[model samples]
Target chain A: MKLEIELIYKQYVDYIYGFIYGMVQNKAVAEDLLQDTFVKVMKSDIDKIENMKAWLITVARNTVYDHWRREKRKLNLMPFIRRKRRDIDLKLDIERGIEKLSPKLKEVIILREINQLNYKEIADILDVEIGTVKSRLNRARKELRDSLEG
Target chain B: MNCSKIEELLSPYIDGELSRDEIIRVERHILECKNCEELLKDFQLIKEKVRGIEIPQPSLRIKKKIIGYARPRNYFLRIIFSTSLLTGLGALLVLTLGHQPYIAEEKPKEYYIMKEERTPYMEILYETEGDYILTNYEGGSL
Candidate 1:
């Protein structure tokens, strides 16, 4: 069991971490989600997962969405308070542009670009059609380019 | 292929996801259409920038924590092994002290206070057991 986990960790840790970090954009939260993702993997029946990388990414994405949903609920209960915005860093323009994208587009971009997954792999991870993945990737790039330029 | 269709294909072309026929068609269209060419460049730039964003690695501590959590039996064994080692050491210490009344001294606990200004949305303050206070302000508090 230990060897199995070590092997899986060696193979997928960085990819899973990158995917979660892209989704959450917070180091601490991303690390927590990464931990949660691995724990889920450890608990799951490994023999059943035919595509390990895609399965891991799917789990990571779901963990991120679960975190977001929990945060949204907490925000709903909290009193509204206005806060000052920090100056945007020029170096982070592209990242911020990605952050500005809609969730669907942002996810496709992350899976494709950051994680370097192919369209078919991304489709498998996202449970979407390959055509949908292509369109989303195209739309995501266009939106990101426009945001950076504007 | 028209410019709009070619534009849509630009991302796939950059990703090397296009088939032989589609790639030939998009390349032919891009060579003639300046707008599509520029759009292709923009897509390539976006891909580069997204790929360039540094992905932070999860810390070793987090990795150990996850592993420990996943395999609680191993962790429990570790705890037991360490405790046993400590107990054996303590037993040796007592055996060597033989009738020399040993007085245990309590050391004063040291406290560290930290204040961090993060973004601007949320402020959190907490106190440690040793009277150390930490105040943290973070932006985009959910």
Candidate 2:
């Protein structure tokens, strides 16, 4: 059991932590949640999880939501960032622009671009159809562009 | 297809996720529609930029901690230590109450004060005790 858990942690620590920190955007919070996530994985029946990446993602995402709920602070407020375009060519405040996005839209964007998960993988993580992933990304990009354009 | 229809496919088009038929349709439409051409440009550019911002990697310390979860430890020792500690404390409290017949007369006010002061701590103790009971029931030391 010890070797099994260590192997899984060694293999996916980077991948899991990146996804968590990408969502939270905080190093300290991410670190705590990373430990919590691993604790959960250790306690669970690890051999039963066929798709480790997806399962880990689902657990991490819920852990983040649970943290937010405990704090009573969701990512509703546009965090304070300068309204400078993130793109060299476009006029979007990349950080502010993403914060402006609805959480659902922002999630799909993060899963796709930051995690580099394809639509199918994202679909599995979000528990939505593949078509929903495509549409959400479409809306998210459009909103991101419109936020910049205006 | 009109620009709206083409716009829906543009994101997938950039990702090469569209069906061949949808791909042909989006490509043909974007060629003629300047608005959609720009939209596709923005989607691709934004996707690239979002990917550009570095994700926070696990610190070496955090990775070590996570790996430590997999390490074997004597949780049974923890269970025994805590159980014994609580049991000893409970026994001491009961013995003190039994010996102090005079203090027992003043118990109502003291009980109220202690309840007010110690409710939160007692709740925590109760939760821990509940976990211990469950752990024993499950035949696991965790």
Highest TM-score model number: 1
True contacts kept of 2: 0.60
DockQ of every predicted complex? 0.40, 0.25
For residues B31-141, what per-residue lDDT tens digits would candidate 2 score against the true structure?
A: 899988888889988888788877656788777767765745578966887899999999999999899767545534221111111110111122221112233212444
lDDT tens per residue, model 2, A55-111 = 998998888778766444322342332222322233226755776788789889888
Residue lDDT tens for model 1, B1-142: 6787787788889999999999999988888989998999888888888999988788998888666654434878879978999999999988889967656796666856655422223343243355545432232221
What lDDT is obtained when candidate 1 is compared to the true structure?
0.79
Q: Write down the lDDT of every candidate, Cα atoms only.
A: 0.79, 0.74
What is the DockQ score, from 0 to 1, of model 2? 0.25
- Candidate 2 stretches with Cα past 4 Å from truth are A73-92, B73-142
Off by over 4 Å in 1: A79-91, B72-142
